[model samples]
Target: MSPPPPDRLARWLCHPHFFKVVLLLALVISAPTVAIGFYADDYVLLSYLAGRIPGSPPWYDLYNFFDGDALKLQANLVSGFPWWTDPGLKLHLVRPLASALFTLEHAVFGHAPLGYHLVSIALYVALVAAAGRLFLRVLPGATGALALFLFAVCDNHLHPVGWIACQHLLLAALPAVLGLLAYLRYREEGWRPGRYLGPLGLGVGLLGGEAALGGAAYWIAYQLAGPVPPGRAAGLRARAAAALPALGLLAYFAAYKAVGGGAANTGGYVDPLASPLRFAAAAAERLPVLLGDALVSMPADLTSALPSGPFVAVGLAAVAGLALLYRACLPAIPERERAALRWLVPGALLALVTSLGGFPGSRLLLLPSLGIAPLLAVVILRGLRRGPSPGRAAWPRRAGAGLLAAVHVAIAPLLFLAATASSADIARKLEGVARTAELGAPPRERAFIAAASDPMVTIYPQAILGLASPDALPCWSALSMARASHRLTRTGPSSFTLEPLGRTMLTGAFETLYRAPSAPIPRGYQVTQCGATIRVAEVEDGKPSRLEVDLGAPLEDPGLALLSWRDGRLRRMALPAIGEAVELPWSPGPIGLL
Candidate 1:
């Protein structure tokens, strides 16, 4: 059997009208989001809007919700933060454009979630279209079309599109992509308007979110590696002019710091400007994981699920193997495609660096995927065409390419489809948990969650309740966030100690989300919240080994109720009597897998 002619094959692979397909795929994949109501930070945003969570900024300034000290006071009052939360924890962000959008949506839609989901879907579709346009500009023909297709169906879009709070990711991406497209036009077509429009678009993107910094990386990459104009002086001038857009990043950073907008005292987020070394360390640790995710189909979210040492090691190995595989296959790639690779590879890596401020997740891959999609498309297309041909000398490269193609082309789409459904289902489950908490807890009684596998189950329910009925908001404390079996020993009439059977508290990835390594809780440290005092009883390896909780009431008090997550459900559990010990089994609740 003979392969089809080159032109025929190219025709089959390329779609000149790929944007339409991208739009359709975006719509189809994101349709399930309409069923997903408020989850995680969406509840917090809504609660703030409802005036339930005090100290939050006005609607337009809502992105600065974590900036004020008043919120910390409010958190202490209601046990909003976990017991392990850093005393000076700050998760401030400057995103006026995204905040304004949220404000506008809430004013118009109020509590009806259908409107928010629709807006998020619309933004996502726009972002996909923008990305397709950018790809077509940089990588023409079959490669560009394939890149658009790969990006359109990428599972990374699931979170940004489905989760309302994550709309900022979409908002940031859309303008950033447009800016890159404009910059490309300036470099490739000599468009005068593009020089100004490119910088303008990036500036607007910065207003959307800090994720916009990734766009500046592409600008830098183009200046460094993109094709130069005919005259040497003219090319230098053009490249120098391209630096204007990157200035937006500097300006954004300056303004952000001026306004006291940045995350601090949290292991989950590292501020690059404030703590450069720590940020570099985090980026170094996270970059490989993100690279593995982009190069192959290794889910970036696994960083949270698995131990850091093993996960980072495996990710680093995958990155090294993929780099070598790409190097082996590079000679087979056309010079034009290889030229694109020079910029694409660097742009993708730099974009990934921009996202390392937060924990690695599929959601953060959106910006990097812009460059990776095209790079992968070119490699995969060339590999498929040449690797399987008879008399190929590079059998090793062929096998490596074949494996890459199998994972990305065959398996990735199925994972995307599954992720689309899974994202919606996770939101539904979280909402269910919030609803259960609202109904199960008595109006006046304080609730204590004995054990919850996921932090979302513990933190967000109170905010959800505040949104639903602020007047009757219940105070609840999550005793344990670890997904491990524990031995609950009753120490006194009003105090109980929880010791994990095999692990120390606040050591897991999710557990560390609330506490930074720099602000470790001392053994005798105590936090009083909602009539209960939580004390760090014992420490092991710099982590809490035993946590003693003083309920301020007898275990048999009818005013207090104990709840434990079991079999994916939050159910009331019997309190251990004084001098009694009870075993608490680990259960991955609805959002645990996420």
Candidate 2:
């Protein structure tokens, strides 16, 4: 059967424009979930936001782009202290937007995961659509769609899209790419030179927020891809011949700085040239991982790909298609049909400069790689369009296009499934309420217990509607409080001074308090058992502070100090340690070891 000549739907599906739109639709579907609750770098920001921590809302909390006062809104509640939280120099505020939106969702959804996750998914979807549309507009063909799909589905992209905190990177890339597209169009038409200024200006402004480097990469690509007089020599001299784009870039840089653009400094966090050899190796190694991530669903027992048998068959077909294009089809390609290849050189260079871990990291490659996709797509589609007789070529072209399309589109459902499971796993780990009960008595019942339980979980206060709501601590706030006070803060028996055994003994006392039945021991160091209590008898400060317990754990070592209040009335213990439970009585502080 001849398939009764293609119907409107069939023709539309095969149309390059339709396929591009379909890709756009896929992008839209992915955006919402990509903007959900904070992840990765967000933890640093959230640490500063907790009311229990010493620091108040930080200055330039969100990329520091806006006025100082706006950033202070996220401070810790109890102490009106401000924290300059980010180690990275840039006041990148992308997280603030995500945090603010998540905060709003928190108000309405009451900590349910779905609402925030939906936002991230939606943002990713929009990003994918924007990228596809951008490519199709530049070069319309099966190849264009294929390139966009590959960029979208590639495994490296999963981290940026799936992780909520990375939305800034995505949001920034979208407008920047659009602006490049607009600028390219402006240049192509020899339109009013001043008109090129507008899109260029917008691209720079957006670049300041998500990623300055990404914006710079695209600008470089534009200059490389731009048309020059046919006889002009390449390199710096060619750019000098027509300096409009250079001027535009200069203006863009000035505007971006004026708008308060800067990225967080990662000076010590990641060595600028951390193991370039290793990174390159990792990138090469990740190719298979990326492919599997993009194409396979989680818990692989549920779904599988066509075996290697079919993959080899398809690979052969693709190779044959490429061979036919160069050998038998190149001569037929129209002269005007080809665009300049000058851009690829610079684009490749730009990609190299920005690439991290070779070719795999999405944050590093996504935007720069956009330039390469369309060019590859056009070449591939052109080959398919010309090979075989017109009648025979039609089926092969359509089949090839479909195969490419399937590979890209299938990525979304697979990624979606994997992300769903991953998010669920993370959510389960955060279900602290149930775990809190297992400890028996509330942590607050004793200072030692509270301190001991701090590692496992500690719920701290958050300011709610202008009221300091210390008791109603959420998991995020609690974890932030525990980490900031116990780890970051610099008040305590020096963690460095304690031997491994001493530290464990000290930690075990705190844990014991939380496990103990209801009782009031002492504010600082005292033990309550069998009705009466035994407090530390004396204190001496020499090389390290020391205390004498009345009737608790005996000295495991003379160096170990027994901290007590008043033997009865000390307000607090500066730094205390216990030798034995029966002789040297001691209690852990509310902030745990700190």
Clashes of 2: 51
TM-score to true structure, per model: 0.93, 0.52
Model 2 lDDT per residue over 343-438, tens place? 642553454354333212334445554654444444444544533356764565556544544544565456554554554444333232222232
Model 2: CA > 4 A from native: 1-24, 27-53, 56-60, 63-125, 151-155, 193-212, 226-236, 240-352, 355-363, 375-413, 431-594
RMSD of each: 2.5, 13.7
Best TM-score goes to which candidate?
1
Please provide, for model 1 over 275-342, each residue's C-alpha lDDT reduced to its tens digit, 9 standing for 90 to 100: 99999999888887777777776778877877556666767887777677777667667777787878
C-alpha positional error of residue 253 in candidate 2 after TM-score superposition, expressed in Å:
8.0
Scanning candidate 2 in windows of ten residues, the lowest lDDT window is 476-485
Candidate 1 residue spans exceeding 4 A from truth: 5-9, 68-71, 74-79, 232-245, 387-389, 392-394, 438-442
lDDT of candidate 1?
Answer: 0.77
